[model samples]
Structures are given as structure tokens and as C-alpha cells.
Target: MGIKLDEEKGLTLLEVLLSIVLLVIILTSFASFFTQSAMFVKKNEDKLSTTQTAQQIVNQIEVSLSKNDVKTSSVCGTLPCLLEKKELSNLLGSPITSSFNISAKFADSVEGLIRVKVSVTDIKNPENSSETFTYIRR
Candidate 1:
């Protein structure tokens, strides 16, 4: 009877340890899943914000081209161009601005189109940059 009682106690101890191990594994898996979900949400939000910025930049450029007097030249030849936020605001006739840096490069080609590249960086994560490519026909 004493030996049987000791065996029963040992078995209980083993069961308790196994239960603890299983609980730890389940908790670890849940934590990992939560972490990955959070990361995915953050990334998606960044992408959406970047896309909005790109759209705003494109609209400003389009408005500028439509309203301003621009001549089609074989070469850019120092045509008035600006890549700064303040200068862009003045050109677009708007007070809108963004934290992301903006740049514009006019491609000289016989197609009579200007290639515009708008790049927007995530304000929270500067290492991530989203670029939008478009063309403006004269």
C-alpha cells in the first residue's frame, strides 16, 4: 500500500510538468501570432498613407501643368523646375504640405510627355518609401 501511494504521487508530479509545458507552448504560439498580426496592420497602414501622399502630389502636379503656361521644348534648357516643398506649394497655389520628401525630373524625349515620379516615405518609418510613376502629355 505504501509503495502504491508513492507511485501515484510520482505520476501526479509528471502530469503537472507535462501540463505546464503544454501551457507554455500554447502561450508562446499566441504571443507570436499577436506580434505578427500587429506588424501586418502597421505595414498596411503605412502603405495606405503613402498612397494618399502620392495621389496628392500627382494632383498638384496635374493642376500646375493645366493652369500654368508651359512650352514644349526640345530640351529642358533650364526651364523653371522645383523639387522643394515650399516651391511646390507656390507652384500649385495650395498650402498643402507633406513630411515626405518630393522630387521631380523631366525627361527629354520626342514623345512630348513628361515623366513624373512621386516618392513618399512613411513618416513613422523613413526606411520605407513608396513611388508612383506617371506621365504628363503636353
Candidate 2:
């Protein structure tokens, strides 16, 4: 007997199932790509945030050095001379104080010249950190 008109016009069960399987395969392949891309974006954002935070700390250090009354001695000689963490935090103020563990150090880059280094560790991810450096006088 000839096939019914409705049956002939519609997709068979096997055809429908194959289409679904193909869709799932395509979607799964693309899913991994999206996930990896998201992770990459997040990592870069974190890195940029770290660098910006470090830069802010460096700017503060520079400002402190530029002051006429700023006191620094020629010690440590390129080795980092640690600054008090609380003092650094107080200098940074509210915007950055809560988000990072800040460490600062200065060394004698040359006679009467100092090299300032500011390092910031992300509070949420301690292993993630950035350091910024600058040279200042006295």
C-alpha cells in the first residue's frame, strides 16, 4: 500500500532524532569555546585590575616623595626596604584599602635617587599580584 499523505509530508522519527543529535554535537562544541573565552576574559580583567591597583600605589609613593618634607635615607641599595602596611593602607584610603594587601618598599637607585616599589595582592586571590616601580629624588 501507498504511504499515507500526512506521514509522507512529516519527518520520520529517525530523521528527527538525527537532527537533534547533530544539534547537540554542534552546541557542545561551541559551549567549550564560550567557556574558555569567558575564562580568558576574566583572567585578563584580573590582571588589568592588579596592574591598575599597583599603579595607584606607585602614584601615592611618588606624591609622598615629591613633598619637600618627605624623609628617605639611602639604605637597602636596590633591595626592597619594606614600608609599614598600615601606613600604606592609610595612604591609599577607602577606595583601595579593603580590596588589596598592599606592600611598599624603596631602595637607593643612585645617590640622592630612590626607587619605589609598590606591590598589591588581591584579597580574594592572594597569588595574584602586581608591582609598580618608579624613581624619585631624595
Candidate 3:
């Protein structure tokens, strides 16, 4: 009698193991990609928050200068005045991140202009910070 093929033959153990290994490798790569994407998004959000905070501080300074709310004599006895942190905090309430720095200086230069500089820093991530400045007439 001639040799006959077995119709009931199925996949061997080696074939099943190979498919499982390949699937695991693909899934692991995807997982790492997702993790990296999440980190990037978080960093971007922090940068945006810092930028908005700096802009807000700048706006507040501009408004105060325009309305003459800051009195040179009362706040600073001389030129190149540094605003008290407490006063600025009271004006801005609570910022997105409490860790920030704002500096507004009034110097008697030839132009009689006030320099307002606002900076916001994320204490946790120093790279996430922003600074904005503007000049206004005294």
C-alpha cells in the first residue's frame, strides 16, 4: 500500500509558541510608544500653563500702571522699585502654580518709562517657565 497523509494533523507546539512571541513583541513596542506620547503631552501642558501665568502677570502690571494704582511714593521711596511678592500674590490670587516670580520696576530714566517684567516658573520642572516684559509711560 502507498503512503497516506494524515488529514487530522494540526499546528505543532512550535508554531503556536512563535505566534505568541511575535504578538507580545508587537504589543510591547506599542506600549512604549504610548508611554512616550503621554509624557510629551504632559510637558507641553506645563509649558502652556507657565506661559499663560506669565501673560496674566504682565496684564495685571499694565493695568495697574495705566490706572495709576501703584503709587511710587507709597511702594518705593526711590527709583528701581521691586514690588513686594505678597502684594503681587494678593493681586493675582492663586496662580496655576504657586512657584513663580514677577518683577515690576519703576526707574526714572530720561524717557520716564516703567519696565514691567513677569516670569512664571514651575518649581518641579525648571524648563517649564515663561517671561514677558513691556514698557509703559509713567
Number of the top-ranking candidate, with TM-score as the measure? 2
Predicted candidate 3 versus true structure: per-residue lDDT over 10-96, tens digit per residue: 888999999999999999999999999999999898889888877777776665554243443455545566664565554435333
Error of 1 at 77 (Å): 7.9
Every candidate's lDDT: 0.65, 0.70, 0.66
Off by over 4 Å in 2: 1-7, 67-80, 89-96
Whole-model lDDT for model 2 versus the true structure?
Answer: 0.70
Residue 7, candidate 2: C-alpha displacement in angstroms: 10
Q: In model 3, what are the clashing residue pairs, if there are any?
A: none
Tens digits of lDDT, candidate 1, 38-65: 9999988878888888888887777666
User: Over all chains combined, what TM-score does candidate 2 have?
Assistant: 0.76
Worst 10 residues of 2 by lDDT: 67-76
Order by lDDT, highest first: 2, 3, 1
Clashing pairs in 1: none
lDDT of 1 at 131: 78
Question: How many steric clashes between backbone atoms does each model show?
Answer: 0, 0, 0
> What is the TM-score of each predicted model, taking all chains together?
0.68, 0.76, 0.70
Residue 117 shift from truth in candidate 1, angstroms = 1.4
RMSD of 3: 3.8
**Which residue pairs in candidate 2 have backbone atoms (N, alpha carbon, C) closer than 3 angstroms, thus clashing?**
none
CA displacement after TM-score superposition, residue 62 of candidate 1 (Å):
2.1
- Model 1 weakest 10-residue run by lDDT: 67-76
